[model samples]
Target chain A: TQLLEQSPQFLSIQEGENLTVYCNSSSVFSSLQWYRQEPGEGPVLLVTVVTGGEVKKLKRLTFQFGDARKDSSLHITAAQTGDTGLYLCAGPNNAGNMLTFGGGTRLMVKP
Target chain B: NAGVTQTPKFRVLKTGQSMTLLCAQDMNHEYMYWYRQDPGMGLRLIHYSVGEGTTAKGEVPDGYNVSRLKKQNFLLGLESAAPSQTSVYFCATGSIRRQPQHFGDGTRLSIL
Candidate 1:
């Protein structure tokens, strides 16, 4: 099984602070996806990175895929209260029909 | 658009009880998935279906079963509830294998 491991499982920061979460895997994947899940709701896809070393920005959030396609990272600039949520990284398995998700990094941006 | 909808937002059952979670989508997606989320465990796939009348086991399929009799609906069933099975359940749908999936709000089940 291909597993995605996330670092800093819990994060608490003040508004305006910057934070970055990392996701790593021993096996390479064809593509990787980032998701943010708020309380009481299912996860919402933030972005999908298909190319190695590719970076995509969504407002204040920036996501980067590893050069070897075995890791990824999510960076939030000037975090806000609304940015507080569980961030997860996932990638398709060998079958490519399903995804394996990371444990997730829970972020809390206090006002 | 009601991308994906899961019935029974919250449910509590005693041991050995049986129940089914219903997932319905209107986006004409061909692939549907069932996942369980636990604290610090991320979302684990329980079952999935590529199309109607076809279901496949996922990473963790023990104690659960799924059926997709219709293209837009997928059902997950628990034959005998166990305390270990208590978790938030989410249903998702996708048009293709590589596309981003659409997920429902989730159903919280508590097995007492």
Candidate 2:
């Protein structure tokens, strides 16, 4: 089974601080996606990185895919309370549609 | 658009009982998935259907079953409930090809 390991399982930061979460794996992926899920709700797609070494920015959030296609990262700048949630990274499984998710990084941003 | 909707926002079942979680999508997407999330374990795929009348097992499909009789609806059933099965379940659907999926508010199932 393809497994994605995410580091910093838990994070707590004050507002305006910066934080980064990493997802690494030994298997190459066709695409990698990052999602943020709030309490009581299903996850929402934050970004999808398909190309190796590609970078995409969504406002204050930035996502990067590894050149080898085996890792990804999510960075949040000037964090806000709204950024508090469970951040997950996933890649398409062998079936192509099913995703194998990382354990997750729970972030709590304090004011 | 209602996106995706899962019936019975919350349910509590006893051991050996059975129940089905209904997931309906109005977006007309062809791919649908069911996932379970534990406190610190992230999300694990239980079952999925790529289209109507098709079903496939995911990474953790033990003690779970799924059916997609229609393009817009996927059903997940538990033949016999166990405490280990208790978790927050989410349903998601996407378009014909690879696309960002839209999700539904999850169902919180508790087995006592």
Candidate 3:
């Protein structure tokens, strides 16, 4: 089975700090997705990167897909208390029908 | 829009109890999925349905069963609850494969 691994499983930072979370995989995927889940709620999709080396920005968040399509990263600029949540990266499985998610990076931005 | 709705936001059951988690969608999505989230395991797919009357096993489907009798509703059943099965359950729906899916708030189940 394909797997996505995330680094820095737990992160604690002050507001205005910048942080980046990495998601790596050994197998290549057709596309990758980023999600942020807050406490007591399901994950909400942040972005989807379909092309290798592609980058997408959402307000204070930026996401990038690796050149080989085997990895992805999420960068937060000037993190705020509201930005604190669990960030997850996922990609389609071998069957291209379902998604395989990374363990996730739990971020806490204190004001 | 009430995109996806999961009933029983929180539930606690003893061993050998039987229960069903209901997922209803109003977006006319063709694909629906059930996943369980643990502390550090991410979200593991338990089961999925492509359309009405069709269901398939996912990565971890050993202790659960699912059925999709209607296009907009999916049901997950646990025949005999086990302590290991305690986790936060989420239901999601997508219009097509390989695209972003819409998710519900999630149902937290604790098996004692």
Candidate 4:
């Protein structure tokens, strides 16, 4: 099984709509990170949450880490067409130098 | 500076053929990783290195091998490619703390 699992594998919403993607894991991580990947490009770091029950906002996107550090969520408000891409969550492994990535959530904002 | 660069953006190989994908990073990171992405699957780690001259197996290391002879460069090699090995390969460099990572575009490989 995948170390991390993401919900709603595919999400399509109209422009200006709001949507949330979730990532869950059974293992605890010191920190969790969110990344967005566009076609023909590599995934880009969006935000990182180091504290349990931490919340971070990046422009129209908000990220939250569960209090247990086993899950995370990314919410985008007033979504735009440019938000169409893949959103992934990752956390460090037991070694702290390697990472285990979530399956991924594909988001599409129609114009 | 180029954050991360991958060579031969795309390639096609016949079954049993061997090839190598190169990844270079300029961020002076101490850790590097290789992952493969397929439809419906998030990226799966194939191999990783904490520093020069050291490598470790990841979740999905089968059919793949890696070498990190130099800190700035990491290489993934396919000893004998199979159709099941067709996927997009990505290389990433981790931050000092390893929370977030910087990734190379990707190398799309096809084995027929």
TM-scores, one per candidate:
0.97, 0.95, 0.97, 0.93
Provide the clashing-pair count of each candidate structure: 0, 0, 0, 0
In order, the Cα lDDT scores of the candidates are 0.93, 0.90, 0.93, 0.88
- Model 4 lDDT tens row, B9-43: 99999999999999999999988989999987888
DockQ, computed on Cα atoms, for candidate 3: 0.70
TM-score on B-chain, cand. 2: 0.94
Interface Cα RMSD in Å, per prediction: 1.9, 2.3, 1.8, 2.3
Residue pairs in clash, model 1: none
What's the residue-level lDDT of B89 in candidate 1? 96
All-Cα superposition RMSD per candidate: 1.2, 1.5, 1.1, 1.8
Give fnat of each prediction, in order: 0.72, 0.70, 0.72, 0.78
Q: Where in model 4 is the C-alpha error above 4 Å?
A: A95-97, B97-100
For every prediction, compared with the true complex, DockQ reads 0.68, 0.63, 0.70, 0.66
Per residue, candidate 1 scores C-alpha lDDT tens digits across A22-50 of 99999999999999999998899889999
Over 4 Å off in model 3, which ranges?
B98-100
Stretches off by above 4 angstroms in model 1 are B98-100
After TM-score superposition, the amount by which residue A54's alpha carbon in candidate 3 deviates from its true location, in angstroms, is 0.3
Best by DockQ: 3
Q: List pairs with backbone clashes in candidate 2.
A: none
TM-score of chain B of each: 0.96, 0.94, 0.96, 0.95
> For model 4, what is the error of residue B96's alpha carbon versus the real structure, in angstroms, after optimal superposition?
2.2
Q: What lDDT is obtained when candidate 4 is compared to the true structure?
A: 0.88
If both were scored by DockQ, which would come out higher, candidate 2 or candidate 4?
4
